[model samples]
Structure formats: C-alpha cells, structure tokens
Target: MKQLFDSVRVGRHALRNRLVMAPMTRSRAQFDGTPGDLAATYYAQRASVGLIVTEGTQPCADGQGYLTTPGIYTDAHVAGWKRVVDAVHAKGGRLFIQLMHAGRMSHPDNTPHHRAGVAPSAIAPGSGMFTAKGMQDIPVPRALSTEEVRATVADFAHAARRAIEAGADGVEIHGANAYLVQQFLAPSANVRTDEYGGSIENRARFAIEVATAIAKEIGADRTAIRLSPGMALWGIDEGEQGPALYRYLVTALDKLGLAYLHIAHQGDEALLADIRARWTGTLMVNRAGRAREQVGADVASGVADLESYGAMVLANPDFVERIKTDAPMNEPRREGFFGGTAQFYTDYPTLG
Candidate 1:
C-alpha cells in the first residue's frame, strides 16, 4: 500500500513525502509583477511539505489579471522567483510555479497596462473582482484572434523556459478555476468559430498546444496541469457535456507523459474514477474541506498518488510535523489571505 508519507518520483526531482502545499494566491507581489520581498520567507517557512506549488503566476503582461500577482516572463520576475526557489530548495523543498492566465476574470484597474482582459470570446464572467479603486465589475474581454491564440501558447512555453532558468523544479499550468485554459474548455466562455473552438477537441486544442509547447520547451517530466471539471464559478458552466469533455481532454493530455495531473474535484466520483483509470502518470487530488482524518485516505485508497492541502498548510507552517504528531492546527485567518504584510503571512507558530 502507498502511504501518504512515502517518498516518490514526481518528475525530474524525487520528493521526500506525499504531502503537497497546494498553490494559494497570497497577492503579495510588487507592482511590476515581481514577487514580494517576504515571498522567499513565506514559502521557505512552509518548505516542510513534499511539494509547494506557488500561486497563480501570470506568464506575460496581458496575462496579468489580479493586482500584485507575480509573473514569470521578465528578468526582474525571474530574479524574484530565483530567490524564492533558492529559499525553498535550501530547506529541502521542491517547488513548481503555477502559470495562470486569468482570462475574463480580470479588470482594467487591476493590471499594469490598464487594458481590457483577453479571452476566447467577448464575454464577461458576470462577476466583480477587488481592485485598487475597490470592487469593480469585470468588463467583457477582447476576444483573441486565432493567430493570437497560437502566440499565447508560445507565451506559456517562454514562461516555462524562464521558470527553469530561475531554478524551479517545474511549472504547473493553471487550467482550473475558470482561468484562460479552463475558459477555453468551457463552451459558455468560449464561442470561437476558428480551429480553436466549437467541438470538444477544438476547445481542448489550446490546452494541448500550450502543454505540448511547454513540454517541448522544458522536459515533459517537468510540466503539469490542474483541472476543475464541472466547476461552475464566475459564470463558468461546463454543462452536461462536462464529463465527456474531461474524458476526451484527459485522454489527450495523458499521451504527453507529463509529470502529473492535479484535480480540484467537485463531487463527481464516477468521473474521478474514470480519470484515475485513464491517467497513467502521477495523480494529485485536492479535496476542498477535507477533514484531518481524511488526510491520507486518497493515497491509501489508491484514488490519488498524492494529497494536497491549501489552508491547512497555509495556516500551519509546520503542517507535516503537526500531522505526524497529530497536533492541533492553527486556524487560517481570512483577513490576511490576500496582499498583506508578514503578520499572517509568516507569523504562524509551529510546534516546538
């Protein structure tokens, strides 16, 4: 039986355990999309986990959606991430920077360029986001031209190269949570008539192309993606075709021999079973609101090769140690979850 604490080969790196610190956006980067000064300390503090997936990092200027989210495409961004990578590595932790394009889930006031966000279609997410000015409605994004779509794929590949240059163990494509990649998979968000949209295969083309490009640029063993099938957030509705689309999408993505596939599941046991059966590589599952007793259940039951925790690890810097001792966990403070100083970022006490 595979225990949660067992060592495993995830990609080019061998992890110390199976506990993963799932990527959580702390919105603490500088105005230039560079990671904040405390980022190194914050991540290094939680380096006890087997893997630490960084927050949703934009790949390019246009990819920026939220205020102060880090990017991976520039020299300063690379330098910022290098410090973070080194901090995590020095503590014996592996890290994968998550490349996220927020798509229509953005506002002009939040980005540096102050331009409308880009997406597969000219549609709004029917929601608002926090900005410098305050809460504002997300505007209808400028639809990407078919040619622009291909260029965007190149942008992901370039970012992957930059991440590797920064000494990261790998990069995870943020294809979940109604981001650009998931926006393309969602028919309601994507209404393109070009080769990039309409049917399931066409809608999945951008993700496959982006993954293929990144896998080619970096090694496939260093590339991974996260998906949230049937996730109905911010006006994203995959509809009844959700399961079918994922079946086809996973089958195609599995052929790439990527490092692993992370799924932010949403109560679809049948589909989850199907995904587990079809996926041949490592699988990581993040169950929202999972109790302490269920920490190692996924791995023990063979549902997932690795189990990820977000809030638990976020609030408890020594999450792995606490789990081992069955010690009480610190409650996550909601107020300091985003764009804050080190009060809640790094002040979490650990077992002595």
Candidate 2:
C-alpha cells in the first residue's frame, strides 16, 4: 500500500509528503482585496502539508466575489501575498495561488468600484451573494465581448506572473466551483453562440486558453488547475451533459503537460478512476466532506498521487502531525468560516 508519508514530485516542486492543503475561501483579506497581515500566519501554520493551495483569489477587479476576498493583479496585492509566501517558505512549505474569476457569482457591493459582474452570457447564477448590504440575489451579468474575453485571459496570465513574483511555487486556475471557467462549461449558465460558448469544445475553450497562456508565461510545469466534475453547486448545473463535458475537458487539458490536476471527487469512484486514467500527470484528489478515517484511502490505493483536506486543516494547524499520530482534531467553527478575523483564520492551535 502506498503510504501517505511517501515523497512525491508535483511538477517542478518535490513534496516531502503526500498531504495537500486544499484551496479554501476564508474571506479574510482587506476590503480593497489585498491579503491582510494575519493571512500569512494562517498559511504558515499549515506549512507542514506537502503542498498548500491558497484560497480562491480574484485575478482581476471584475473577478471579485463575496466580501473581502484577495486579488493578485495589483502591486499592493502582490506585496501582500509576498508576505504570505515568505512566511510559508520560511517554514519549508510550497504554496500555489489559486487564481479564481468569480464570473457572475459576484455582487457589486463586494468590490471597490462596485462593478457589475461579467460572464460569457448575461445570465444570473440564481443565487444570492454576500455584499455590503448583506446577502442579495445575484443580478444578470453583462456579457463580455470577444475583445473583453481576450482581456480576461490576459488578466489570468498577469495574475500568474504576479503570483510567481510574490514567491509562489506555482499557480492553479480555479476552473471549478461555478466560477467563470465553470460558468462557461455549464450549459445552463452559458447561453452564448460565439467561440466561447455552445458546444463542449467551445465552452471548454476559455479555460484552455487561460491555462495555455499561464503556462506560456511561467512554464507548463508551474501551472495547475482545479476542477470539480459532476458538481452541481450554487444552482449551477451542466444538465445531462455533465460527465461527457468533463471527460472532453480533462482530455484536452491533459495534453498541456502542466502541473498536477487537482480533482474534488464528488462520490464518483468509477468516474474518478476514469479521470485518473485519462489524466497522465500527477493527480491530487479531495473527497469533499469525507470522514477523517477515509482520508488516506485514495492515496493508499494508488488512485491519487496526493490527498487534500479542507476543514481538517482549517481547524488543525498541525494537520499532518495530527494525522500521523491520530491526534484529536479541532471542530471548525461554521460562523467563522467566512468574514472573520484571527479567531478562526489564524488562531487554530498546533500540536504541542
């Protein structure tokens, strides 16, 4: 059986263990979208993990969603993230910034300029987003023109470069979670007939272009992508074409020869096995909401190169040690999961 402590090579970085800290949105950045001081300490605490994927950070102003999320397109943002990178690096950890474009899942009140959300099509996500005025129904987003779409791709490339400048090991395009890339992939959210919409090939085009551009900017080995196949979250559904869409999408991305492909497995072992076969490079699997006892099974069976945990790592700074010795885990505070300060963000205790 493959052991969780076995060393693994994920692209250009050599990991000491097979434990990964999954990218999670904690909404702890400044209102201007810059990472705050406590952010560095929070990430540094969990540096024992082989790999740490930072929370979903907006690649551009229009990409902002929810309250106080961080960004990577500005100088201030870069400097803020640099602190975080330094902290994690000092503790002997590798960090990858997850560049996430919220698309239509954004609210104007959540951003500095209070800009309207942008999407492939002028469709609403059929949900509410937390804003300055509290939770409000998402509005119909303005459709991006062909030129604007190219600009958005450039934004992702720019953010990837900034992440590298901020001392990150690599970058992971957040193509899942009903965000911009996933919005285009889902038929219900994307109603455009242009090159960026319609057919599966077209829907997957944006994500491919973004990934290719980022890879070109900072080598293919330093680029990665996170995808949640068959996930029907936040009223974003791909309908009857979900499985085929991901199969086609994953196969296309596989040829890029980028870094590891992080998969948020949603209870589909057979499909995951199929994905593992389809994808040739390293694979990081996260069984969302799985019990602690089942965490290492994916790695043990050779189904995944690494395993990631969210709530476990969120509550336990010394997650790897806790897992290694079967120590007690701190219960995650639901209320402090978002829009919180040090209490839930950086105060999680380490094994003494």
Judging by TM-score against the true structure, name the best candidate.
1
Model 2, 150: alpha-carbon shift in Å?
Answer: 1.4
**Runs off by more than 4 Å, candidate 1:** none
Per-model TM against the reference: 0.99, 0.98
lDDT tens digits, residue span 49-151, model 2 = 9999999999999999888999998999999999999999999999999999999998888877788899988888788987777779988899999899999
* Model 1 C-alpha lDDT per residue in residues 273-307, reported as the tens digit of each score: 99999999999999999999899999999999999
Q: Which residue pairs collide in model 2, if any?
A: none
C-alpha lDDT score of every prediction, in listed order: 0.95, 0.91
Candidate 1 lDDT for residue 29: 98
